[model samples]
Target chain A: MHEASIAASLIEIVIDTAEKNKAEKVTKVFVKIGRLAAIEIDSLEFAYDAIKEEYEIIKDSEIIIEDVPITGKCQKCGVTDTYEEMFFACGACGAFEVELLTGEELTITEIEVD
Target chain B: MGMVDVKAKILEKNYSKAAVLRDKFKNTCVLNFVSSPGSGKTSILEKVLVMFKDKYKLAVVEGDQQTTNDADRIEATGVTAYQVNTGRACHLEATDVEKAMAELGYDLDLLIIENVGNLVCPSQFDLGEDAKVIVLSTTEGDDKPIKYPVMFRVGSSFIINKTDLLPYVEFDVDKCIGYAKGVNPELEVFQASCKTGEGLEEIAAYIEGMIAKKKNA
Candidate 1:
């Protein structure tokens, strides 16, 4: 799964930042993944747990994931709506020119450390 | 315990590597072809690539789980092809492309990467390609675009392959294009069939246009 690769990258970032901050151990890793990012949260957590075992700094860390809903603003009618489906058709104007406002994120906002 | 504000993308490492590759491929029009297994990605390449092999310096990086068959077929077309057997990996990462380029050298006008025959994972990994050309054959359901919207969203060009089978299959070309457009309105769509050689010239022209655009840039 691509989540395994994403988890490895997340671990790399966490270790790099923890070392730079002079932290002895990392306790929590916080990340935000959007609906449109196409990532499965359980798969990502499984991968994180599996990969974190190799690094002592993050071995005991727990990952906190915030799933973001896909939202878009209609480019034609200026209406904002949360998209449950993959289609981006505007809810108000029925235009396909809806500009995505969120739900494509794959960012780590913060981490807790000792 | 203190919270260290990292505020970074999870795949930042790959993105950074891809950025470097993008810079290195300034003169090379690199296109990553992605699709499900047996979507005729290599077939389209085997046919379309021969059209430009004599006119331009071209090389291919074939990604598969464990075979050199695709690479060998590409090489038979009189072009350089490097096979990257990803072992257990389902997709090719930017590091894989970098390693392939190390062996293939960077003296090419065009670099075609036939991604591991997967639609889901490959869309997430950027291989420093100018465009992600997605191939979908008629045998696959027309609703595949909506089913795999992320791939359609990231892809620049969409190819509906095996148009020769349209008369026999239940695939609806218009509905498929509509679904793809619903996800990405900017996608350039094309219908192609390798067997009858229908709609291949336009695909070749589109690739040539990309090569020219990269060279002029």
Candidate 2:
């Protein structure tokens, strides 16, 4: 449901990036999404298919969404590591008072256009 | 012929606009209220607006996927209202809120964004709010925070609304409060009922005090 709107934002960013590079139409848009970015990848891809049809430039473009794994830091032992789930508890330090170092990314990195 | 690294934060574009909007709202205190459907957020706002309408220059941006009913209710209470229909979007994003802000004008002392009735996504995205408030009704099971700790953890205040109906429903207030505090110890929790306006006084006072302090500061 929310993926559709996110997809719309993706189309806007990709098109803008392509135009800034003097390209007419976007061929591919690449984005890295954190595993814990709270966005479902399948829904986003489905939304891209449904939403891009409205924009002629992106109608035939491909949306490449990369899954960025969740990473965390331990506040007690000063150890940092990446995990699959959203927990920040340190495996090395066994400290739960850790902070999130990454995994909350939902950005557009590059666009290939022609 | 080969792929080159083009790493960038995808949501940065939205955040850039959201950051500008936050600066614009520096003068006007804003709160993004989140809750499940039937948590009485709209009715609670209605009661609060009537009580503080004259003293506070309040505006509301109603986020619903379809209807303008919430905005209609806000307007009926003499507060300016702008409706942002997400057209199936669950939460109100920064861009959706930015457009509403431009349309609603800037004369307001407080801007309350009533997000779509979902405890999940609304808490995830920040719409440049000074603080996030979660309305927890007595009708819903009291273990909500334990189940949805993320929402309770992020919220600055917990509105335990529908207190007047406590006799009718079997809600464990203490359990919810305990878990909410366990997750985020600094949370300020309040119990209220829009029907009886039982605990709204404190909730209104809390909001009033924050806005007053911000302006006075």
- Top model by TM-score, which number? 1
Chain A TM-scores of each predicted structure, in the order given, are: 0.98, 0.89
Tell me the deviation in Å of residue B188 in model 1. 0.4
**lDDT tens string, model 1, A1-114?**
789888988999999999999999999999999988879999999999999999999999999999999999999989999999988889888999989999999999999999
Q: What fraction of the true interface does each of the listed models get right, in terms of native contacts kept?
A: 0.87, 0.33
The i-RMS of candidate 1 is 0.8
Given the true complex, what DockQ would model 1 score? 0.88
On residues A25-91, what C-alpha lDDT tens digit does candidate 2 reach at each position? 7778888776655677999999899888888877888888888876777778888887653444478
- Stretches off by above 4 angstroms in model 1 are none
Q: Where's the lowest-lDDT run of ten residues in candidate 1 chain A?
A: A1-10
Q: Which lDDT value does model 1 have at B48?
A: 95
